[model samples]
Target: MQVTGFVPRETADLRGRAGGPLTLRYGPRAVVVVGGLPGSGKSTLLRRWDAPATLIDPRTTRLACQARMPAALPYPAYRPAVRLLHLLRTRAAFRRPGPLLVHDCGSRWWMRRALAHWARRSGRELHVVLLAVRPAEALAGQRARARTAAPRTFRLHVRRTARLLAGIERRGRAAFPGARSVLLADAVSRGRLAGVRFDAPR
Candidate 1:
């Protein structure tokens, strides 16, 4: 999404709350909102961590595994309501006490605010990670990955990804302010984040 201006540097220190692992003492009840263009490794990172997390990915919830949201609903008509319901359900599910809730979505501003509000009311911490890979690099990577799949599937994914990335670039920071945008190189090299940190209530 060509994230320019005020590129953040690596985090100097990331000690846990009480000088320990950044484990949630209140409970494993927290949320990690991950946002980025397709092929930016958002899913990869979540898979790599493999933490006991409740993921709220629309593609997964809609078309892949469970039909949390009906597939028949047109995108524009059903998206907002479905997403709201998903967030609500996910939050309520964690209310009884469970692992961290990781929402692997676009990480748009509205989504971030909703999650942050939920966290505060539920007394959970919110962590945001933005996977800011260059558009060209991401597109190339996506295309390469798609080649392994069926032609029809690959074409659909590529087209959808292009649209999503374009939306993010057009929206800019207004799309996701709580997120810390990091280039692929920086994320890989430093293994840390640099960008303005947004407190939960922001």
Candidate 2:
């Protein structure tokens, strides 16, 4: 994993598939955004984190919306409402105190920009943990979890996620203006990573 911003460099050298448990440490007021393609183990990774961060996962809002809506109502019928509510909840989270660990798909520029804005205004640093996975792997992950997306929707997410990753590579630090660090983790590296931690700044 490469650390790409205002922090001291700590090269993870994960390309070699080095074996060991790894933890990402950040400031107590950091906003660590976990992102990947749909069904790319983002939720699974977030769930493994036992850090005391304020968890902000879209699944939480989506499941709540699903419960409140009629069972006959298809997901498409309430996806918009779920998204809106998730946005509102994410915005509100930035107002409260403490570290934040958010699950984002990394495809929505608007949401990321909004998060950047909040992090900047609140004197907090924004960081990203991007899980770069193959579409085939992601699809298998979806199947394993029994929560597959429509083929069309899944394709769109893959395209968007690919483009986002490309942009991050092409733009470097400019890809995320307010981001203090960007950690790119492939399957091998991700598997070795144990969790995240928030500590007082040295």
- List per-prediction Cα lDDT, in the order shown: 0.47, 0.79
The estimated TM-scores of all candidates read 0.53, 0.89
lDDT per residue, candidate 2, 56-171, as tens digits? Answer: 99888988889898899999887888999998999889888999988988777777789899888888888888888888989989999998988998898888888877877777
- Writing each residue's lDDT as its tens digit, candidate 1 over 79-157 gives 6666666666666754656545354544344556666666777776555455555555555656766723345644554
Full-model lDDT, candidate 2: 0.79
Give the C-alpha lDDT of model 1. 0.47
Regions more than 4 Å wrong, model 1: 1-27, 64-81, 147-187, 190-202
Q: What is the lDDT of residue 62 in candidate 1?
A: 44
TM-score of 1: 0.53
Q: Number of backbone collisions per candidate, in order?
A: 1, 0
Report the Cα lDDT for residue 87, model 1. Answer: 68
- In angstroms, the error of model 2 at 50 is 1.5
lDDT for 1 (candidate 2): 62
